[model samples]
Target: MPSPTRPSSPPSSPSSPALPPELLLLVVDAVLPPNPLQLLPASHPATKTLLSLTRVSRATYARATRLLRERCAFVDSARRLADVLLCVPRLVPGLPAVLSLRHMTALYLSPFGPSLAADDLPTATRVRELLCEVCETLRRLVVQMPFGSLDPLDDGHLGVRRTLREGFEQLHRLEEFVCLGSYPALSVPPEGNTDVWRLWPELRRLVLFGVPMDSHWLWWDIATLPRLEHVVLARPVGLDAVNIKDEYFHKLPRDDARLGRDIKVVLMDLVYDLGVVRTERWREIDPEERMTVEVFEVPLPFYGDETPLQLVTEWARRGALDGSVWRLGGTRVRGEEAG
Candidate 1:
């Protein structure tokens, strides 16, 4: 002990054991619930949290990044939509390689009018190219038209409209397609053929917030989709937007050879918009057949977390008398909840 022993280094405390990958995934799912049909907006708090998690560690980054890409990527502007095609790091902590766009399966494109930039032409083209690139993998798509219409008369933001029209033409593998905000006159394909059913042969669910002008095309198309199971016609405007007539019923698949599943149509009406009702009352419009129509009096506006898509899906599931008032918000207040 003659020589003073060098001060012993303080014992290092053991780092907390890393969370199991399974448990970590559970936490991630809980934080950002997986909704393939729902788009995770980048501005959303949950989305921001998930983006931050990508930098936590290699393990967390990989899992979080994977989940983000798998879920619907919300694109609000031309530039933002173009970004999805880029090979740059989506977030900081650039330890990992750039995310590949091939993993994107769902996409929501919402172009705001107020924020429209003059140089959007090139960006819009890139997005169209991006859609072509991911067409095979894209399964669910939601296009929100805030200030423009797919109709040529109210033609505004033609680029975004073209993107939407072309996106539909390209992404034929879609299972679910939703149009929010203004009326998207997607009834007729851009090619002028009224046979719009060919757009998404694999489509199962269609939620249109605004009905198209050519309601005949809408009816005709619904009859042909072999895989179509659900159709939500919300806030029907004009005289015959969702006018379910005997002729329309006649178009329905009469034989089992054509329709393997029953087609459920939910005609949704908001509290504000009041318009002509072609059918004042409808009861099991072809109960014996493969078509069933239900009219829902949606309690709230088509905004917020409880979107028209979520409400119509819940309301349509309730097996009630066709045209009965199935109040949405809580349990079936006036109808038989489906067993």
Candidate 2:
């Protein structure tokens, strides 16, 4: 008959119970949206603060790691890229399983100091996998591989060529490709069936600076890209005097004549080099057709001498002396000719 032992009173709830570390991480992850980080705002305090938080606690470390690996893709340091790939599984295992690594699309590679050798192919392969895995989503690619003084005969060039060919092949989804320095020399023939043409079918914008202009006919291939609307050939060397003549106009397929028909602007700066000037015969071409060709000559000062404006003015004065039409007038310059 024992009055049934009264059940022990329920424990009183604590005023501010601590969140378990795992639960805290889950909360943080839930609050963060997995989206690619914008590269603008040259100076971002939030990014700096978030990077610093990774050092605070294990929970913060997990949260920060998830945010970075899921959103940011940078190639400033190869070692950093390696670290991110390797650490992703431990920090954010779910990311690799669910997210396409290539969606974080912009890539910047600098080969200025030394050529990337065959030994670097393993990491390059990982990068290629990441790129190809999300090829359907990539839009912009920026590569800065400086040729430096290496001879084309060296094994380094072979390695570079292989890497570039493999990498470029995977970037079939690229719309904008910017290559700085002199890697991936544009010696590929300008035939319609070339790999370059087949690789980027939708590329609309291309920027090649400080690279040799091996083939002016390559522009024909560029003109054929399905949706190419703008072309900016900057600092072109051998093909400066080359103009878009009727041959090109005719060669361009009218399959969808609308491709480059709307391309109303072109910017080119070809200096007066004897080899290029003599090799290319522009005067023999039809002036009436040439008159319709629009080109803007941008003055560049060699040996770090005068400003470009100064050079333009000097050339203008010289044109006046020679009784040539070359003066800054309305929407067009009166005397200065475009090449």
Candidate 3:
């Protein structure tokens, strides 16, 4: 009889090599996407996975802290920021930099009260100072202005801009920009707000929610922006639209080499003829219509439903179907403002 064979030992698992801090951070970026935790609710498995990364190592913890700090949507904006950040420093070991918000990158601003109130001025100023400090790294930004009140001198608009001009001009790196609540009647005065939108050569995408796309020079700015590739008018309800002239479409096969790709403009509702009312029906759209108009629904109005970052992400993916599948961009903060 053959001797009983000894039980075979199970194969041992290989240990992962220790990655350098930079590589480790890159790994975290690839997996977690800045602050993926906010995309999911607290009890969600994905949120748990992202939150778990905070404890993985000293390097990851620091990155996580910065990600959290980048977009702090306080039910109360003032004390909440300091209270949240001050407590975190003790938890993240070895990285002293995480304690200071000097490395912070993004901010979300929403005006409070019926109109910009006098008492709120100090808070607005404080927020603006914070924006100035982070101007170097800040890329994606969200500002909520009062509806139908974007007139340059409106006290409410003035109240929010207490810090806007000072810090906004400094954001040379500002890329994806979003302004919510400003309807078609509301507009960034071209004369007063030239620096607000025009200065950023790096700006590729601009989203204006609840905006009226008038033929005014402000709407026409889309054509002049050298690097702008996409413009989205969420909840747009205008008889007409502004777009790259129809002449460009006819020239596509020949001019595509020069045109490369036409800047895509989207609307939430039908494209009305330039002077038509929102309710007017068109038997047929004229072939000469200037914009490449597609009808897309603005994300549903619900808390935690859509974020400015998420809106940009969707537009980016649509603009380049074969290129970047933007699952999310910047640090998403479930919307503080609504259309």
lDDT of 3 by residue, 1-339 (tens): 999999999999999889889998886666544443223223445335546777888878767656545543221245643443445335434555554554444445543533444345565565556566666777666655453433446545445553545556677788767665453232245545453676677777776655544435544456556577766555554535532243223333433333444565555321221232231121122222333444453343356655553564345333322212222222211111211
Each prediction's TM-score against the native? Answer: 0.71, 0.56, 0.56
Between candidates 1 and 3, name the one with more favorable lDDT.
Answer: 1
TM-score top scorer = 1
User: Model 1, range 1-339, lDDT digits (tens) per residue?
Assistant: 599889999999999998988787777777764433345678877778878887776767777777677663777776676566674224445577645666577777665543333344465466567778778888776665442423344435554445545645777788876665444543333554443335788998776655653466676677777788877666655635544644456565556454446767666765444354454323344445455656556566445687554564344322111112223232211112222
In the range 36-107, model 2's lDDT, one tens digit per residue, is: 323211134544545665676666665664454333344545665565556434434433233334444554
Q: Considering only N, C-alpha and C atoms within 3 Å, which residue pairs clash in candidate 3?
A: 184-212, 239-272
- By summed lDDT, the worst window of 10 consecutive residues in model 1 runs over 330-339
**In angstroms, how far off is 232's CA in candidate 1?**
0.9
**Ranked candidates, highest lDDT first:** 1, 3, 2
> In candidate 2, what residue range of length 10 has the lowest lDDT sum?
325-334
- Our model 3 lands, by Cα RMSD against the true structure, at 11.7
RMSD of each: 7.0, 11.5, 11.7
